[model samples]
Target: MTTPRRAPRRAPAALLGGATALALALAGCSTPSSGGSAAGDGTVTITVGDRPSADQAAARAIYDRRVQEFQKANPGIRIEPSETVWDVQTFQANVAGGTLPDVLKVPFTEIQALIARKQVADITDQLKEVGLADRLNPQTVKIVQGRDGRTYGVPVLPYAIGLFYNRALFEKAGLDPAKPPRTWAEVRAAAKAVAEKTGQAGYAQMATENTGGWMLTAQSYSMGGSIESEDGAKATFDDAAMRNALTLLKGMRWEDDSMGTNFLYNMNDIAKDFAAGKIGMFLSVPSAAYQAVVINFDMPKKDVGLTAVPTGPGNDNKVLSGGSVEIVNPKASEAEKSAALKWIAFFDLGKYINQEAAVADAKASAQDGGAVGIPRLSPISPEGFERYKEWIAEYVNVPLENFTGYTDNLATVQLKTEPVKSAQEVYAVLDTVLQKVLTDKGADVDALLREAVATVDTKLARAPR
Candidate 1:
């Protein structure tokens, strides 16, 4: 059955144009007063930012329910929640205006930039107070912890890259729906079969700039390649493992004819198309499963499947963990800080809120016959697991066996050392070189690698310790 498409929401041209004006106007403003303790009466406001998602409604419902519960538990504390669209530029403005939320959520990838600017608050002590320093998913902790050995945020949820497949297409192609690919060779073979037999695009690997080389990172890491060395001082894109990874992606796009030529489709578009069954299988985050189920609502449950990311030759099975961490603003008042930390602690320790959110996400996906894959945390109790398991079993069928193991070892694994000068510049050069290699097969890979290495080395030399 074909899913009905919703009309795309378009931003007002005037509003888009006025962003700079708004930013300038807010630039000089003092930071918002973190709601001080009302001697146990003041409200604590948490401003959260997120990418809009189909599962967001359910997630928000879960948030509201939990907040209400928390309010009841602490009658003197009022929780004010505000949602903002995830945009770095706008978030920076909010930061400048001192209107930044006391506790805010941001993408894991962007946290480095925020840390560089000293915009995010460090909450190592708060974490210790909440006894969450060790409780948090180690992989999640790694993403938010700076080179200074100080952690800046508390992770609410964690996500990992994985293969999402259309079961109907798999069956039609005479492939086993239950056994998804576990390695790159298997994936390639399966995609070829699906495309040749089913006459549909086998995969939708992202090759676009708008995604900012994220898909490349996924593919590269799947091959056990590091984007930057362990110290984060240099680009490793020219390394042997990375070359192989990039070559595989390039082969898919240029030789295999599995991917579309236009790389402009952002990750969301890719997920939407996959949900519509236009594509057979694709690499995506666990959260995309929720989106495919609710937003597209086209593909039936019997047709969807989820699996851990496929491995490559010379690569161990590893999936990059991606998600945000909640950070309390440093400038917030003691009361506000206390309240924010309290909320973070609640999220970490409160059984009801975390389980409810996961269950809601799972149910939403199940509504469309898709499986909900909660990253990092599994349901601790039978009741909590059952709440979502019924939907998962009925629609999106996947084993709930421990996938967190794959991320746990890597989560606390530092990819780079902190205070790396020219970190951004090194990344930029590396991305540019990798793009050239991926899109232009005829390009000299060795030359590009050498150039990237030189550029990174120069930056490292110039960076202050």
Candidate 2:
């Protein structure tokens, strides 16, 4: 019944170097004696994760209320909750310690691996049972399924890669903060101006760990390139588009001296610096960056301006899509699994489909001083989300307009998925490539890409078919 303090947002989980294997999907050890809907006593107990911790008092209050409300509606289910959140580094340990929450959220990056390890339950039947099989978003469901066509998780929060910029820096550099860079060329120009005029790192990059590769992938997608070929069996970054992307970074760092002194920033490093106004423009989605800025780094909320990923010359403005999925633990008892599904349904999906719930949740978030109405890519149909918006209209608190540049392209921009194989490994290797290119004046784009291709191909060959 007591809440723990919230840690600063855990977006750095993206930069973790290795796959968590079976651990990432584990809810606990072995199936329980109790079974779903068929428990002899007709009662089910389940453990859920991401309980807001003590750090978010208002959000925690709302979460607790929702749990009570859910139990009231589903009289047969009893819930045990934890503040345990999904973090890649602790994943294996959590599983080893037999503490993995029965129903927890995980990122899209782990879906394929979870399915391969059979760590998560196949929730296809449950989806059908709950009527969510049809209501789920089609595009995201692809990311939630296994190679055998079974559903492993339910996609909840999907986001597109966007350019995160310091609006105050833009104004100081004599640039229009409202009009962010529309193309890579514009980004280069803006970096130069911010560097010379403001004497700050006009641009920054997450050059360490998997983030280097992650950001590179986003850049490649923006520039109409991909790190892997369509078959997902080989490396494919040794081309002009990718080469051009790195070349731009090189120019900004060496020619313009626009990038900051730090060449080893991961998500955490970049976020702290970006939030402190030491950097101008970088790439990230809004939520994580905003959390770090306003909540962690203590930056003013208005300073965080976001825009869509700057486009490559020939690409039609494609941005990488990402989000977490709600997956049930494979080891859970049938009853526990069923209870977990219901928890997910009521906790996440309920807000989207139910008018009063949406309004109430939004109001609670606003009261918690949480950012609301920050536009994001959703896992529901556009129409469904629009209707949900109507319910929360009055409680909208986040200055959504700060993200006009990012949201303006939502209707027209294309959404791209992560590479199918060895994404973490590929990104880890790419990290070195970004570091070398950004820090080494003579860094050869062709040679670096060639070396990366060889490394990535070796890793991809080990990927599960």
Candidate 3:
């Protein structure tokens, strides 16, 4: 069965466009008057974003229940739920308008840029005092932190790109679906088998939009390539790791004849094809694998399988990680900030530690027919995350065993964030390079790397610090 696709997520907003947004935020924001004491007086009122819209009946019901429960548990803290959520286009405008929720959930990609732009608050001390400092998933923490070691946001759900494989194709190829490839050599063999047996694209890639560069970076990391300098000042991908990764792709496409003829693919398009069984394996997150491919694409539940991003000769074994994180408004008062942290601890962080809350959350997901039991990179210790998973195990709807190859190794692999300076711009440039390499048999990898690096370096030089 096939289903129509849901609208793709809004693209990340251009870096601070429109003079009015800058002018409004730069002019200063309206501050919320502090009514309650900073020390747990029931008087502090805080606004939180990401309230489920009324259209999302099941989710909204759970959200309302949680809000009421939260307000009751912490009487001294009054909670205000905002329908205002993150959108790339209007986020900065909201920031500029000073109309942002005291606590807003934003993408991991925005954390560094927001910090660099002075759009979010520095809550290092507050997080430390609240004991979240020690417990935060160290891997996810790296993405939100500044060079000074201050964190701008608290990661709510972190995920690493994994190989989303079609189990039916694997079975048809006489390969083990649960045991996904660990290295490039293994991937090559599996791709060959899947293509030869199923007459499908054994391994496809996201080669359009900025996603092309995004996946390329991930593949490059598996081969130990760096895209930029530590200070986010220069290009660093013109090396062996970069070439080796490209060479491997070249072999898969031209030599082994594994990848299919179609080269144009964005994240959404590829998910649809993967779900339709036209493709065997691709890079994606659990949400994409479960929601986009399985739920929306109507793929067989058991046919969808996953494993960690494959590793190569690159920088040990590491995966590129990303997810949503909550940040506080810079204009919020000290009491407001404290109250905001309390709300975050209660909402985002609380679910993992509180048994009732965990079970309720999972049950809500199950009731909503949302995919439950999708393994992911935790924003806390892997062990703690596993325990939380067990707490809600009864509600698990997806096949957990299929994801073991990815989840079991989360702690052992190094989690790498996107390029620090002009990350989107860098990806855009690399997108062209990737297209060139895949489309032209005679394309020179070294020349493409040097040209792309030069372009990225120039953009970095011109970027605002």
The models' CA-based lDDT, in order, is 0.57, 0.76, 0.76
Where does candidate 1 stray beyond 4 Å?
Answer: 1-72, 78-100, 112-122, 128-135, 146-150, 229-233, 253-264, 293-297, 314-317, 332-335, 345-443, 447-465
Candidate 2 per-residue lDDT, tens place, 373-454, comes to: 7777767766787787887889776668888888777755677777766677888998999999987899989998998899
Q: Which of the two candidates, 1 or 2, achieves a greater TM-score against the reference?
A: 2
lDDT (0-100) at residue 454 of candidate 2? 93
lDDT of 1: 0.57
The candidate that wins on lDDT is: 3
Per-prediction TM-score to the true structure, in the order listed? 0.66, 0.78, 0.83
Candidate closer to the true structure by lDDT (higher is better), 2 or 3 = 3
Model 1 quality (TM-score): 0.66
Stretches > 4 Å off in candidate 2: 1-37, 44-69, 78-104, 113-125, 145-151, 229-232, 314-317, 328-340, 462-465
lDDT of 3 by residue, 17-109 (tens): 111122222222222335533343336777888887999766666566666656555555667888988775577789879888899887766
TM-score of 2: 0.78
Q: What's model 3's lDDT at 438?
A: 86
